[model samples]
Structure formats: C-alpha cells, structure tokens
Target: MKLQVAIDRVSLGYAVNLAEKLDSYVDIVEFGTSIVKDYGLIEIGHHRPAFKHAELLLDLKTFDEGPYEFEKGFDAQADILTVMGAAGADTLAGVHKVAQNRGGDLFIDLMETGTDKIAQISGFTDAIYGIHHSHDAVAGFDAVATVADFHEQFPNVKRISVAGGIDLPTAERLAKQGIAESVIVGSKIIKTADPVAAAKKFMEVIK
Candidate 1:
C-alpha cells in the first residue's frame, strides 16, 4: 500500500514546506480542500511548488462543472484530483475524461454517497475509488471493517484508497488487509510535533 500524507488547515507556505519535507517519505502529498479554497488554484498554479518524488493530489470535491475544475486543477500541476461520488454520472464522466486525456488521475471520494450511486459510478476502471469517512461526522469509523464491506459490495472496483483519521496501526492493518491501493492520513502525521518522524513511523509500519 502507498502512503499519502495530507497537509491541511495550515497556511499555503506551511503546506508547501510540509509537502517538500515529506516528499521522499510518502508516495503522495495532498493539499486538502481547505488549502485550495483558501489559496485558490490560480495562485497555487502560478506559484507551483514542484515535488521531485511524491505525486500531488488536490481535494477539489468537485460537485459540478467537472471538466472546467479538472482542467484548472491539472493546470495547477496536480497529478491526482478528487471528484465527489455524489455527482451525476455525466459530471463524473466529464472529469474522468479530463484526467485521462491530461495524463492525470481521478480519485472518486465516496463520502456520504449511497450504495446505489456507488453501483452506478463503479465502472471508472482507471480512477481511484476512495473509501472515505467524513471528518465532521460524529460517528466512529472502522477502517478495516469498512474496507472489507466495500470490497464485498464492489468487488470489481480495483483501485481503492481510504482516508479519515488514519493512524500507524490502522495503516499497518490496511497494508496487511491488501485491499486499498493507498491510505490517506492527516492529523496523525501532520499534527504531530515532528511530522517527518510520525510519517516515517507510519511508513515503517505499513511496509
């Protein structure tokens, strides 16, 4: 499993620094939705902080105007961009096409999406299907169980990624579970006193 470190709820400068620091350790470095909204894609693109090792993922959470949003995101040098699973099929297809043609990847965030909608949108063979748990939700999340159930329900969706409150032990379990292609962790790594050390710990456990 690949490790994705999410940098969020911080200033743009800090996010870039963190991304640069964690580049060699993590497979993907994500600029969370807050970063995009705060700094805007135009600014981010103009001042693109290049990464030599890790791929960059932007959490756009696009609900409409899929093609346009995706175009701008790619222009901003993001290797992977996220679209909401709750979006209409046409919108999903539009963004998926943009990603494919631009040599970028799409991550479909399955947060608060129903089973029927998931079934309808499960055919994007190349896109990463994210088994997400909402940050604001009051309920607890069981990453392992949720992944297992999702696999049973959508056995055909091969490229799976998971996120929300992921820690070292959970990441290890996910790696052992062998279902998710990547695991996203935010506060566990980012909020630590030493984020690089925390990230290395996660990396060691997952490996």
Candidate 2:
C-alpha cells in the first residue's frame, strides 16, 4: 500500500518546505483542500514546488463545475484531482471522463455519501474509489474494517484508496488485510517531529 502525506492548514512556504522533505519518501504528496482554497492553484505553479519522485494529488474535493475545476487543476500540474462522491452522477461522470481523457487520476471522495450513491458511481473502472471518513465527524475510523466492508459492498470497483486518522499499526494492518490500493495520511505522518522518519516507519511497517 502506498502512503500519501497530506499537508494542510499551513502557509505556502511551510507547505513547500515539508513537501520538499517528504517528496522522495511518500508515494504521493497531497496539497490538502485548505492549501488550494487559501492560496489558489494559479499561485502554486508560480512557486513550482516540484515533486521529484512522488505524484502530486490535490485535494480539491470538488462538488460542482467539474470541467472548470479539473481544467484549472490540471493546468496547475496536479497529477491527481479529487471530486466529491455526494456530487451528481452526471457531475462525477463528467469529471471522471475528463480525468481519464487527460491520463490523470481522479479520486472520488466517499465522504457522507449514501450506499445508493456509492453504488451509482462504483462502475468507473479506472477511477479510484476512496472510502473517506470525514475529518469533521466525531467518530473514529477503522481503516481496515471500512475498506473490507467497502470492497465487500462494491467488489467490482477494483481501485480503492482510503483516508482518515491513519497510523503505523493501522496502516500495516490495512496492508496485511490486502484491500486498499493506497492509504492517505495526514497528522499521523505530517504532525510528527520528523515526518520523514515517521513516513519511513510507516513504509517499513506496511512492508
């Protein structure tokens, strides 16, 4: 399982610094929703905080204007862009198609979406279906259990990713459970004293 480090709620300079250190260790470097909304995508390119090894996944969490948001995101050099699962089927399909056509990855954040909605959008073969537990929600997450349930519920949706309070033991357990394609981490990895060391520990544990 791949680890994606999410950097959020920080200044551009601090984000860049953390990103630079984390670039080689993690599989994906995510500029969380706060970063994009705070600085705007256009400004990100101007700084050109390059990702040497890892792919850049921007957590746009887009709900509407699929094409417009995707276009701007791609222009800003985002390798993978996110869209909300709560969005209309037409909206998800539109962004999924756009993302496919561009040879980029689209992640459908299954945050607060009903099972019916998940069933509706679960047919996109190549698009990654993310089983997301909201950060705002009070309930703690069980990554392995949620992923197993998601896979059991939507067996046809092959590509799966998940996020929410992931830790070393949970990450390794998830990997051993053998479901998620990638695991996204935020504070557990990014909030440590040495993020690189923390990420390395996760990698070792998962391996």
Candidate 3:
C-alpha cells in the first residue's frame, strides 16, 4: 500500500517545506484543494519541491472545463489530477484524454456519485478511482468495509484510493485489507505538531 500525505490549509512555504521533508519516505505528496485555492497554480508551480521519490497529486476537484483545468494542472507539475465523478460524461472523457495525451494520471473522486454513475465511468481502465467521503459530512467512515464494498461492486476497477479521517490503526487495517492502492491522510498527519514524524509513523504502518 502507498501512503499519500495531504497538506492542506497552510501557507505555501510551509506546505512546500512539509512536502520536501516527506518526499523520500512516502509514495505520494498531495497539495490539497485548499492549497491550490489559497495559492494559485502559477505560484505553486514556481515553488514546487523537487520530489525525488514520491509523485505529486493536486486535488483540483475539477467540475468543469475539463481539458483546460487538467492542462493547467499538468503544467503546474502534477503527476496526478482529480476530477469529481459528479461531472458529466463528456467532461470525464475530456479530462481522460487530456491525461492520456499528457502522460499523466487521472483520479476520479467518487465523493457523492451514485452506483449507476460509477458503473458508467468504470470503463476508464487507466484512471485511479478514489472512494472518498466528504470531509464536511458528520458521519463516520469505515475505511476497510467501504473499500471492500467498492471492490465487490466494481471488481474490474483497479487502482483504488481511499480518503477521509484515516489514522494509524485505520491505515494499518487498510494496508492489510489490500484493496486500496493508496490511503490518503490529511489532518491526522498535517495537523500534528511534527508532520514529518507523523508521516513516518503512517509510513511504517502502511508499509
């Protein structure tokens, strides 16, 4: 399993610094949507860390103007860019092509999507399908059960990633379950006093 650490709602310098520190230890470093919104893609690109090991993911959460947004994200040096599953078929197809042409990866965030929609979009064999829970939602999430259900429903969809309130125990459970390719942890790591040490702890469990 890969550990993807999300850095959100912080200054650009701090986020970059954290990412640089965790670069060698983790599989992916994510610049959360808040980071992108706080500091535009131009500034982010100009100051992006030279990741020697991990891939960089920018949570664009793109809902429209698929090709344009994806192109810009790739230019900003994102190895993987996300689009909401709630987007239209045309929009999904557009971004898929853009990612293919640019040789980048597409992550479809199934945040509030229905079963039928997931079934429809499951044909995108190369894209990573993320089983996500809304951060704003008040309910709790069972990461292992959720991933198992998603896998049972869409067995053909490989490269699964899960996110939402994952901690050390949850991360270990998800790793042993072996359904998700990546487990995303945000505040559990970033909100800690020492993010690098926290990230190392998560990396140990996930490994």
The lDDT for every candidate, in the order shown, is 0.95, 0.88, 0.95
Put down candidate 3 lDDT per residue, 99-199, tens digits, no spaces.
99999999999999999999999999999999999999999999899999999999999999999999999999999998899999999999999988999
Q: How many steric clashes does model 2 contain?
A: 0
Q: Flag clash pairs in model 1.
A: none
Candidate 2 regions with alpha-carbon error over 4 angstroms: none
Residue 125 error, candidate 3, Å: 0.8
TM-score of each: 0.99, 0.97, 0.98
- Cα deviation of 83, candidate 2, in Å: 0.2
Predicted candidate 1 versus true structure: per-residue lDDT over 57-103, tens digit per residue = 99999999999999999999999999999999999999999999999
Poorest lDDT segment (10 consecutive residues) of candidate 3:
41-50
Q: Following a full C-alpha superposition, what root-mean-square deviation does model 2 have from the true structure?
A: 1.0
What value of lDDT does candidate 1 attain over all alpha carbons? 0.95
Error of 2 at 21 (Å): 1.4
Better of 2 and 3 by lDDT: 3
lDDT of 2 by residue, 1-207 (tens): 888889999998888888888888889889999999999989976764677898888899999999888988888888999999999988898898889778899999999999998998888898888888899989898888889888899999988998998888899999898888999989997788898999899888776
